[model samples]
Target: MPTQLLSAEQSTALGTKPHYAILDGLRGVAALMVVVFHLCETHATSHLDQVINHGYLAVDFFFLLSGFVIGYAYDDRWNGMTLKEFFRIRLIRLQPLVVLGMLIGAALFYFQASPAFPAIGQVPVWKLLLVLAIGCTLLPVPLSMDIRGWHEMHPLDGPGWSLFYEYIANLLYALGVRKFSKTALAALVVLAGAALIHFAVTSKGGDVVGGWSLEPTQLRVGFSRMMYPFFAGLLLSRVATLSRVKNAFLWCSLLLVLVLAFPRVGGAEHLWLNGLYDSLSIVVLFPLVVWLGASGHIARPGTARLCKFFGDISYPIYITHYPLIYTYTAWVSATRPTWQQALPVALLTFVTAVALAYACLKLYDEPVRKWLRRKLPVMQ
Candidate 1:
């Protein structure tokens, strides 16, 4: 799979780069599934019963995918770049949405007054602001100051925790991991993958779904989840042999949806079996999905356009949509609405999230990054 070339006008309009377009489409596909998963969570009494049972694995997919992209994009360019410059580019690309997510979460905090969070109504404005301030820095809030009753690092924006780990990944790449020899990186990935497997199998819930808290066990889950896939992705980029695959995007996407949308592999009686499923999917299945996506070229005009649309919206939709999920979660928690009763409202939440993400991408994220690129001039 040779790099796709763009004409001058197309390059100008879409920005310059040789991207794995199918990979972009896959990412967008995963992001959309995440929203559906969160919506289904509203109806679930617990993780065991949740629909879209394995959607949390999308974050691991994202981590692996991120590492691969970063390696492919940046690994050879460090000679011409500084650590400060690298951090600046990542921040410009990612931080605007972080700020927007926190703000949206804060705005909707009170409106989400429901029985699940009985103390929600009594939470102080200043405390909310304090949490917002911390969240803006992408730092975890302590249990003492838990504002949303979920004890999430970012109570206002639950998904901010992933971004926090993402930042850590970037920092490691910039400071140290990028310097490792392939053999060293492989060792790291192997160790991390083992730890991830152990954590998944032994986890109380028998899944690696615990990345939002600041507590010790959850912190282990977060880092365990983060390490293997991110580094494996990096390794994949270094070693990938890009062979042409027919209808690769369609096939890869179907696999992704099936994995994420599949029912829990094992019920409560055999939790460890499900853990094995989760670990294997992250360590094995996800990399295959990414490889298939990367090895193909988009041949059809319609498919190319579709991948472009999804690729563009993927990050914006991901970072911005969780705040809306918070509101939906509140609603469902309060009303205990059946799927039939909640169908219309759930559909509305999905549309609103997609619409909001698109609007923010166009009006806020893109414009901000453009300006940052102009002013900073070192975004690579």
Candidate 2:
């Protein structure tokens, strides 16, 4: 919301940088789409028929944004900042919500017991507590710890898998990638792009729609999905030139929705076609949107407020929304309700997710971060 990624004290110590208001707004747009995508996912028999067909790409877009933001915020700061400091900042920003999301999932775990999550009823209280404790640390639990039977690394909160990968990306950048020269970074980006294409187009399922588990194959999917957009975003930040794009937020948001909500590119016969679509979206389209959003300006107070609001809650909603979706999925699985019949509940779920995210943001995340900033010498 403040445009600079740093806290107020840190921003003062370091000079303030311009905030990408439009990019923040675009992130919110994608976050909302993700919620819709997950909701619609329950109704689809498979990826081929899923409504909001490309919503999974939002994760890739998020990676890109994270790279861009990390570069923008910290690329120049290593001269003064230690890796410990950087990790502390990231954990302060991210971990509180991770803990809360897992707690919410644990709280709602039993209620979600249905045909879809067959193991939920059978999971003992001790196992649930163990999973919750591991989840609070953002560590991946093994398959034997998967009490939900979905094979998620964090079965209590499925979306925690992405956060696990996100931390890996942060560690990679902090440890070595941040030091790469521009030419070397470009080479890395190109190779990552190739891996992404190979995985998306060659996989039997098609599309870059995985990365939620810890198995060898799923690990491949996860890394392939992460490497490109993130480093591409980092490269773009280094090399990008800015020019004003009028109404950039509006146009970029529209394009993002169009691509994400577009129908599957090829049906069951041509899985690779959808995979190609996924590749193009992450490899080409997502960065374009980020560039445009970065280049644009907010002309009106109302629009500025809108972007700020969306940007502020974007991460909170994303990290918290899926637990509700797990419940919705269970409901849909048990009842097999038609779209019309389920429409109201789905809408309510969406609203509830939004409200819950905002509540967590104000009631917990902000206060905790403020406390961390004051108490942690690194943040100070």
Candidate 3:
């Protein structure tokens, strides 16, 4: 996460630039929470009752963080970099793991057969290959080709849809949004926030969870979910001032965990409450979290090392963990295991997810990126 951008300061004066180290660790925290949320999701009877109630909001938090990071990292440097160069750098950093995630998903696809995915074994290898082909390009497979009953754009790896939108955000920034005046960017944020609020208040479940599909409604949800926070983060990076804060990493981590782990408010009778909560958390709290993280430092060596380790593996764990989740989900769906019966499998799933992520990061992601950087010396 090294950058060649302005160090945020109230003075608007030049000084030593710093990376948002704690924010990286906070991202790892959210990724871990997502893993826990999905694992718990397998046991829940419905979305309304799922444990780790606010895990979905982590996606929104991610969008906000991404916008801020993009602005912080690349805004001023665009003077020396072409969009082509920028895209190449992003691809080198991000695409290898995307390919790895799809491969893992494809390899595990058949093994995931269970009552919920009874067709997994029967699905043709060609179809699976077709999915891999499309997934590698980050395009959603058509509904006609959907192997799983769920209409996920990337059925093999459910998390890929978020990456799809991530690319959209990147492209939008490169093409137009980056040039927007702060006033224009703020207006976009306001409009996006409204879209998000409308979707949340109207949703029967009062959540922002349906962004995986490619249909009109789902795409609307996806963009609505994406728009405000991404732009707001960009805006925050451009305008907000960072200040020294005590114990920021700890405080921001707790704040993130508290918001994400809090139970769903306003179940059926008052849906707006949950929607408002989601809105406020993203629009208000996430920027504060980022600011706080930016303001803090890791002074203790051991904690610094731990944060670095988790931060290093964060993206790998997130992008790869969901495939194992598919298998675990299928098993739970078929077996309907009580928590007592399910505990061991759950534990295994959690351990395996971490191990697989770490392995993919070290054995695949790093090697591929290193090769790309060597090959594309210009981007270096």
Winning candidate number (lDDT) = 2
- Looking at model 2, residue 295 earns an lDDT score of 83
What TM-score does each of the candidates earn? 0.96, 0.97, 0.94
Local distance difference test, candidate 1: 0.87
- lDDT (10s digit) by residue, model 2, range 179-276: 99999999999999999999999998988878888888999999998899999999999999978888888999999999999999888899999889
**Alpha-carbon shift of residue 175 in model 2 (angstroms):** 0.7
Put down candidate 3 lDDT per residue, 57-83, tens digits, no spaces. 999998998898888877887777798
**Model 1, span 76-146: residue lDDT tens:** 87888788878887887789889998999999999988887777899999999999998888988999989
**Model 2: residues >4 Å from true position, as ranges?**
1-15
- Candidate 3 global lDDT: 0.83
| Candidate 2 Cα lDDT to native | 0.88
Ranking by TM-score: 2, 1, 3
Runs of candidate 1 exceeding 4 Å displacement: 1-17
